[model samples]
Target: MCWINKIESIFNSTRCSEEDKVRFAVFMLKSNALYWWNVESVAQPNVLQTMSWEEFVIRFKTQFYPRTAVRQMEEDFLKMEQGNRSVRDYTEKFIEYSQFVEHYVSSESRKVKRYILGLKPSIREFVIAMDPATFSLAVNVVEVTERNKNRQGEEKVVEKRKWEGSSANFRSSASFRRPKFIKSDNYSSKQPPARTCPRCQQVQQETVNPNRKDVTDAERQVIYQGISLYLKGVFNAIHLIIFGRTTHN
Candidate 1:
């Protein structure tokens, strides 16, 4: 469907909160951008009966990004399901509804992005599908992870390309030694070697320069370990590179 009409419908929706509306909107926008917007994905990945675009889109989101979209859709349904039902009586039903959706949180990207946008025609034509309590819950996951803060500094997406059997960025970047205290406690207290990466297994004793134009194999490993640390939540730190600050729960 036209994107603008969908927005009008949601905005006029009195039952949903402001947040659900936005979440539904985002879900739609992202879905259209990914699936219907792309051609090859149209034919049935499954039963290929020359699927109508809408039927294919819904099925795709349900099978793939259901957590992203279906979970929210389910939430919206449950809230309505319970709107007339009493909290005291329908509490168990509510929990069941939530559990049903949460179980699918890890659905593939196709489904997940659809959920994020609420399946608008532009998007939904791609799982266009939301409610009051449902909308609140939509933001809750983001809040639990706390990914909603205003960004600081530059909004950047660093792309790493593979080259010559090593990540090009890691292979060529200079290494930064940790401070003395970190070195002592974690890195075996070795003093920073003058102008060279001591961690590298030196072979044939070529003159190792810390400022070498090309990083030795050791530097690439260091970069890999550093990324692993970030993903593992080893520490909450604000690098000037990401957001102004890295937050931890």
Candidate 2:
């Protein structure tokens, strides 16, 4: 119906002649009528032979959208919910169903209330907190909030992927360019050769021993020599005293 209205508006805007507009409308309707059995039957040569565009639309709408169907549409509108659907999709669905009873939902306050009631809980809370004055304002706020949330979620995912990729690349490149272990000729030359002489080796062994005593060979020899010299001097002094006494008697 909206598409038909758009075509009609284009014809009016371009100032097409009434005869041309009628011809175009009839062609479009007949061309599409074959797809639907009811439309094909209703759009027969005799029924639409003398019908105008307005008359054809009225008849078509009357046949398809009866009073019962319009009442059901109103019920559907009342039960509509935004659950899991995007705000734009929900809005389009609500508007399409509400068209059947636009007279009742004409007021801004009523429309706003109905729209807010159908929104998903998360978005509804934010919108109500904002307390928009008009239905348009409510829609704008909800849409913006949902878009921002979606954008942030996408950014987080992208950041995580970038971090993972960078870490993997760093590991791969580090493995490829690592410095190899090359044995240098000068490495062995820099270390001193081990001592081979018996005396030097023994000294080295003693120096490295953890349990060796603290006394040295030079200190023991000095102590023994001093005792021998003291004994010899005492014996000579005794002999000299005895001989001198005997000669005096």
Instruction: Provide the overall lDDT of each model, using Cα atoms, as 2-decimal numbers.
Output: 0.42, 0.72
Could you give candidate 2's per-residue lDDT for residues 116-152 as a string of tens digits? 9999887888888988878889889989989988998
Over the stretch 30-113, how does candidate 1's per-residue lDDT look in tens digits?
Answer: 565545434434443433334443454455445455566755757674343333433333334433344345544334442234
| Candidate 2, residue 14: lDDT | 88
Top model number, TM-score: 2
> Tell me, what's the RMSD of every candidate?
31.8, 18.5
Top lDDT model: 2
For candidate 1, the 10 contiguous residues with the lowest summed lDDT are 123-132
TM, every model:
0.16, 0.46
* Candidate 1 accuracy as TM-score: 0.16
